[model samples]
Target: MQLIKPFRKLVVSVLLIGSSIFSVSSAIAQESSVESRILVNVDVIYPVNYLKEEFKKISSNPTQADVVQIGGQLNFSTIPDIQAIRFSRSFIYDPFANDYYNNRNVGGSDFNYSDQASTSNPFLSATFTERKGNPPLTLSFNSSGSNPPALAYNGTSCKDNDGCVLMHYGYSEEITSRNALTPSLFKTILKLRDNNGNLVSMINAMATPIVTSSSGGVTQYLIAYHEQSDPANNGVLMGVWTEIPVASGISSNSMLLQKQLKDIVQNQSQSPRLSYSNSSNSKITISNTRYFLSSTQIPLDQLSRTSLPPTDSRFMPLPNADGTISPGETTKPVIIAQTQSAKKAMTWVINNKVDVNGETYVQARYDSKTNPYSGDTSVDQTLSLLCIRKSPELTSNPIPEIAKGTTYTNSWSGGEVFAIPEVVGNSLLSEQNADNKCQEEGQKRYSLSGFRMAEFHDGIQPSGFGFYAKSTDPNLSISNVRYWVKINDQNANPWSK
Candidate 1:
């Protein structure tokens, strides 16, 4: 089989942890002329220890078909101008290659190339594990060496503690629109999220706006950084190209993207319905969670991309241990950037009682503490993730005011507690709590009414407000306001939002 060969020599700098910065020594000339386009080179840096372990199996037992593959998907939807994409080349780079060729028995082959069929999915592929064929891109590693070896990219010393390998792959895509002398957008932005799904801001997380090379109607841009600390497992890298000469660095505060979520119902049904007293101050802007969702709707509304936040690890491209954005590097700013296990406080107010198809359902109001009454009710309280169970002891009664410093209370009949401004019912008030079930079912007969993440301020009211059957049960007729705590701690309950 004929091999689609990669360039004989391509210069790649090592800007990973404990590695020195290297310059590109040369560039391969384009074989043919092409239309103006953008070249996005995505390099996933794997730790030396991680790779050593990953390849141990294949190296120990060599086989003809055994190969190691590592790849990730790229997202570019944030860039509005670019509308189409085309696949480019994929290759592996070994910083130790030159040393191996120079009669120094330090490691294995420094450079290797292979061909993979391009697919519509934007996954960049790299496969190298055990050698099999002539001109093979795979090889076995020899860990027998005295002193740690020096990398070809500027003689940077490498050790297992902080060394890294680069699997560089890229795509060439056409921009939907642009100007005459300059490209539509120059700088690219990357947002990082931690494993906990919270946005993390670091000075080095954003790619440096550097135009590494421009040749043959194709412009290449490079983004180099260490693997994020506590990175989201499914994080993605995105960017756009521009003709602008200089790129700038972004502020740490700007790293965490901001979003606003409005509380509005997309679907509402009466008889078993949701009613909001007013819409005043019914929106919330947050920067903590990876994304937010619109609260109090028939079907919850998604308000933002579910992108994971970038790692807090210093962006390693700059090469300094201190890892700060250099004044010179700022010239080309690439655009930048189930279970309820515990008890959580919940307040349920009686909105109304409805009989639906011979089954009795209860509608309760849930809202944030600071929101004003939107419609006709005067309910005031904050909502939380909760499970509700029918109380065999109490009838429907309102506990209007709980003191500010009070922890939680289940007692009722003190006074007439008004209904909450935001009321939710319909499908949320189910005959069976199939969507959410109580984790403490063994002890208490509590069942789940609804479940929601903390990012959503409003959701279906607590489960205890209504009964599923209207048979001879006396509690169904005079069901009153009751509060049941739902577990909301993520650490304790994986289902906690």
Candidate 2:
């Protein structure tokens, strides 16, 4: 009996240990199945090998190119994951990055990028190429110009020797470096052409030594071609470029997105409208009634652009901070200096094309005057204890419908700005006539997509929507316009590849 009892206890212990092992194994399998990874629609392709051979040839002696493909893409989606390629210059940039790699003949607006060095600006691909220096090597904005200017012997010529193709690149000065390499690497082949538009030379730009985020990197490559007397007729056009593949991340911090939103609102609450008054100019010719916004107000004995509400010139009474109401108080009030009759308020389109993020896009307004209040205007109101501190904003916004592209993932409409005053006053005799104190006034500027109007009234409509352009034709006018935006999004990165 004693022997049998001991054997039974051993069997129970073994069974309990087996149960724990199975639980752990199941958990591990579940976690593995759901891990996140990055997925891209296109893969990156580099031109390093071809470029290396071509560079060898150039060093032997400069020469013009034959037709070559600088950028490449799979005719169809390739399997597995997208490839990212990186391209590095033969040498590192100077501490100030002011060498010929970043400077030389480029000047004026083109050199504006040089000043961005402090911010570690990105090197963007040039939209177009130009010639510079004394007789600026015969160049034209229109590459196809029939009369090519004569090239200067002392002008911008082919580098190293006469056999050089002119190439343009966007550069970022080293203000600060995140060295987000891999993702920043790119590859492409240079296909050269002559003034008459014939293929002249071709070379592939190759890869560089692997660089980590710790050590900043450069974006560059080189080519040589015969200097054309009329380079415009013989100038080279840019070809395909591809981004090198890199391990994907969710990208930066989500807090940055939130901060961008707050900035949009803050700008709207204080931006101004545009106005023009030539000592002369009158009404319209057509039956059309042009609309405009006017912070303009009547200068009554006490009312000014700085007027407060109730007895002030701009807006009505604001509920007291304590949430108490006074006798004979009305929910709304009339101000003597208002730019528009509250009843005339209609809709507005407020923008001229401006840069947002890194591109230029315009906004599409939706909320009309009558429907303005329907929008969720939770924009914060700044309160100032002392005038020196930025005061709380007293503003409202009309809802907007922004333009979007297919596959657009999200939309953020900061809405249109509306400026008004606040007042806390009452009808009394001693404290009497309820002295209306003027609170600091402010303006709201409309901005979405990172840009707001630099000047106001760019799009002010008393009745219709606002846009940056204008046309006399009624059928194709703002009234006839309609806007729609579409969107798409994918997980930027996943735990599992």
Winning model by lDDT: 1
C-alpha local distance difference test of each model: 0.23, 0.20
The superposed Cα distance between candidate 1 and the true structure at residue 495, in angstroms, equals 56
Model 1 whole-model lDDT (C-alpha atoms): 0.23
The number of the candidate with the highest TM-score is 1
Q: Output the TM-score of candidate 2.
A: 0.20
lDDT string, candidate 1, 1-497, tens digits: 01111112222221111212222222221121123443333333334344344334334322111112322232222221112222223222222221222223223232222222122321112222222232222222222332221122232212244343333323333322111111211122222222223332211122212121122222212222222211231122222111221112322321111110011101111101011011011111111111111111211111001111212121112222112222112121111110111212233333345454454444333334211112211112222223333332323322223211122222221211112112232112221221232221212232222222111112222222222211222232224443222223221121121
For model 2, residues 70-121, the per-residue Cα lDDT tens digits are: 2211100010011111122221111112111111222222211111111122
Please list the Cα RMSD from the true structure of every candidate, rounded to 1 decimal place: 24.7, 29.9
- Measure candidate 1: CA RMSD: 24.7
Return the TM-score for each candidate structure.
0.24, 0.20
